[model samples]
Target chain A: MAVNTIHREPPEQSAYRGVRRVDHSPQIFNNQPARYYLMWLLLPAVLLLAAISLYPFVWLIYMSLHEVQLAPGKSDLWAGVDNFTRLFSDKSFARGWVTLFKYSALCLSVEISLGVLVAVILNNSRLEKLFITIFLMPMMMAPVVAGFLYMFLYNGTFGWYFWLLRSLGVLDGGTILGNKSWAMAGIVATDVWQWTPLIALITLAGLKRVPQEQLEANMVDGAGPLRNFFSVALPNLYPFLLIAILLRFMDNFRFIDTILIMTGGGPANATKILPTYLFDVSFKFFELGRGAAIAFTLLLLTILLGLILTKIFEDPTRKIKTDGMD
Target chain B: MTSVTIKDVWKYYGKTMAVKELNIEVRDNEFLCLLGPSGCGKSSTLRMLAGLEFISSGEVFFGDLKVNDIPPRDRDIAMVFENYALYPHKTVFENMANPLKLQRMNKTDIKERVVWAAQMLEIEELLQRKPVELSGGQKQRTAIGRAIVREPKVFLFDEPIAHLDAKLRSHMRGELKHLQRRLETTTVYVTHDQLEGMTMADRIAVMHEGVLQQLGTPGEIYNHPVNEFVAGFVGEPPMNFLDCRIEGAGDSASLVYDNMNLALGGEQSRILETKGAAREVRLGIRPDDLTIEMGTDHGLELSAKIFVTEPLGGDMLIEADFGQDRMTIKRKIAELGQPGDACGIAVNSEKLHVFDRDTGEAFF
Candidate 1:
């Protein structure tokens, strides 16, 4: 046998023969260190963030410590903790937190359920892209505009919905926004209409990422559609669902605009949620110190809620492995 | 176990026909492989049998039942996808026990069955691990175990081991064949690899362009391909083909290519005359059937220059150029050859294949 050895040079040695290595030493600018350049590069964004976010936050804290009279002849006075003390004693302020909780819970639950149902239905449809675009129209509309549109539609005299409710004997010709019992329900309905599509869009993306093979395997394993959803599809959608719910929760927690435009905290403050109360205290009655106090409290609550949700989202097993490093 | 029969089944995706007029019967406890290249409809036919895909027309029967309208779950079939398809969030035990749980079986029985399948696949120790934590081969075993725990009427494997490394794939091939035999279930496997099909299947069905080209045992399919496609597709390094013309009739017929004239054997010549074989045909020969020597000594020998030599462990594959045509010959490693060297080659007339040039159908 004539065996010929095909001698080939090592690839790295041949390819690198004429090439020069890149310098890894730190670079300098104008006789300054690399950190100086980094600081300069970040200066614009840092300054802008400070001007917009930090400056306002510090001013709010400073304002919360002093009572400033809106009257031209009056002077500002140091209030110490008096404004915060008033926050606890104010009945409307206490009721606002309760209203905020109820609204967030109701809106988030209904939105997530309806969004998942829509996403699942659209996932199997042949005209998925067309229907998805159509379904997303509500979310594309500005929330304040949607609120105004719903307000006109909920009017007792000429609104189509009011007439339908009266014909159906559900409302007996009463205005949806004017009735105390239906005021919160009307605001919640408007929020659901405008924001449910956001949840649906995210859920649809998650549904698309579910492996087709796994679903087929489920079918072959004797799972019906319902069983497949519970065992396979639902588990795969958890991470995305969690994210969607968290976003909706946070947004609903600070909700104000739609309620402000539609109900204006009417019908004996039935729809007076936290942000609406904040607006009423700060701009309407001009209680700048107490409004700043309420604002600071809401910020703290948001941060705490975010931390708790993030803790829940972390996988316990992954957490344990990371904790072992300590 | 139940035998599966597909009768005149056709599948269409939009306007494109994926599987056309397919009819096949997988006997009870039989291991049948659907073998073809990509887009050849082998996977489509298997999916139809599994009831994962609807048959565009015709019927599929399991034993005495016509299952054309039956869903996959009702058909009592289990499948292992190419990606394994083990539930990512579930432990191996949960994955294996899922089918039994869906059947509403008791907890103890489900556990026993899952453990038994795990042991069968030699993955008992990894039963508690999630799919993401296991290696590819282990994941494949879990998928097989999931199917096994179902103990369904038929097992459908859609290139299940295609993703594994070569060594693991070969090992799993043997394991799957043994497991299927022990379980005595009717199994239909699909793969584009001819080697996997030849090694594992009791019968091989070769498809091309949505049409079944040939159906036979591995030996029969390799020895007697019905068309040029199967002949070219089945062998390692593939069979070499030369454009040639058949002249004369009966026993005097000969194949003429370039300046070489080779007389046909008696059996081939008789068969060709009966078929009214086309004058323009392709002469097919496996590289293993050609013999190369240092110089021409026989009347049937032809002279050619060696183009290249590839040593593939056990044998040397030589590409020899005869005029403008090139044909590969598998020779013993002891047969020394260099590029530009002239060698005499003789084809084994008994093993030669002849096909119509235009239609690609074999004459015999």
Candidate 2:
């Protein structure tokens, strides 16, 4: 596919003949657009990709429009916009969306703030290499495994975190995953502990790329070390932070492993986020059509969020102008 | 604004010494250029002066106060970096006004000062644009404007125009020198280009291998280099050196080489006689000093075959073979020669330089 974009003529005889610049603009033949030969060659792979991604999406829409059959050889019943219409009246679906946002917001805010702070401190520390490796250990653990680990820590019987919280008079002897007030915090803590390091790692990479000359220039311009970070380093880190946030947001819409393991949507559906609710509707009640409807809405929201983020990315104020990047 | 003195300063990054026992005093309101090739410690010396890097074991006095321990923020200095490190997020106006804002200057004053600098640099239209939107020359101008707006005590420019295109570089060189003169701030400019140093600096300090080779006016450094490195590093197409033996008995000393026997001028011959007895020495001459003509001319002591002729429009550079050494002669392109063609070379008598062959020290 990439080969189609390259000018097919010999490089020395091409437009950049004398100057030695590698001109990668698409080849145009006789003042007309060039044919994409490589695209035809990649048709098989493209078809396979379409089957994997497109087929399921089409099946989802189809399933969302009908009462899907559970047993083999059973005919499905048609439901005309009934499933989507029912979603407006269902309180659990509404609560699930609100809870999903609350959960994601809680996790993202804590992760981004704490992770960036950790990254800043660890960037040039004496033990930077050692600490980076140590901090990344949490991200290496499987989410399901981390959930089980945290479950033990949140246990009312012998959990050390529970004991610490109780002794500190912050918990009032309530188990983190059992109480309504603490269950949301419990999953958020678990997510933060498992994924905050990923944000830190991305931020650290961005921190490494913050122009050294810019920092030195700022120093000479009469800014202290702290002000230097605020003025120069933070602005450079914005794109990286935005990418990290979007990645985590997308991940939030998909990941239900830890929540399923730790809370199972909680004692009274108090911790039921949309993904957890969708899992119950799809797997527990076998309401495949309703679940498909819910899943489609979640997918739509994600796409919408992605588009908005892309709009923000393309905003001129945030984009640093670069030369010959295309 | 103030005289800056670097006294016996040395910089060691880990175990490697970048600048070794360097001493230089940039006079009040004088433009001093630290000139050298890459890894020659000129940038490191400038950085130490700007208080960006710590001096290993010496004093850097800004007037009377030793600024060795002071940070760059407190040093009251502005530096234009090689890459023109303007803030990517900020507009040119904001970038220029940053220093004034750091001083907590009033908004109206900051805006006025920035506008004034923008007009001086002829970048008033570009002030609203970010660094990325600007061309290489525009970015360089913005970087210069940022430094000039502050009116700091000293300005340290680290090859600020190095990244510009050839035409813009020459243009900026003149403008930068003019700006420095008008501002009358003590400026330490570092560049590897000899042209920049010769054309812009009041005094050029030629450095090589972490050592100060010579500190003199451009003419002095160009004509009477203290050593071979300064002579070679400070000229375009560089000074060509020929290995020869000094073989005269008394006041008449002549450099002898195969196919080349050149008599030294009376003044240089007398200086050589005062120095020591006859010995082997290397003769140095600038490309402009050596004359090359087609065919043989018997009166010219040295005759050699032409290697190549490169015509650079109005001028010509002819590389001629003097036994094992090749010498380039720069002259107008009125005469032309082909490769392997015989040519006569004439050495302008007074411009000849003889160096101690072993030590590479200048004899005259």
The lDDT for every candidate, in the order shown, is: 0.86, 0.88
Candidate 2 lDDT over residue span B75-126, tens digit each: 9999999999999888889999999999999999999999988888877777
DockQ class, candidate 2:
acceptable
List model 1 lDDT by residue over A1-326, tens digit each.
10112221123454656877765866754665456688889999999999999999998998898897788998878999888888878888889999998999899899999999999988868999898788789888887888889988898878887787778888853589988888888988998888888889999999999888999999999999899998888888877888898899889877677898988988888889988999999999998988999999988998898778777765322332212111
Clashing pairs in 1: none
Q: Which stretches of candidate 2 lie over 4 Å from their true place?
A: A1-36, A313-326
Two-chain DockQ for each candidate model = 0.27, 0.31
Backbone atom clashes (below 3 Å) for every candidate: 0, 0
RMSD of 1: 7.0
What TM-score, to 2 decimals, does candidate 2 have? Answer: 0.92
lDDT, candidate 2, at A159: 91
**Residues B1-364 of candidate 1: C-alpha lDDT, one tens digit per residue:** 9988989989999999999998899999999999999999999998888888888998999999999988888989989999999888778888999899999999999999998887777777787777767788888888988998978999999999899888677777777787887889999999999998999999999999999889999999999999899999999979999899998888889999766788998888999889888889999999999988864553446889889999999899999988878989997887677898888888888899999899999986
Best by DockQ: 2
Q: What is the lDDT of candidate 1?
A: 0.86
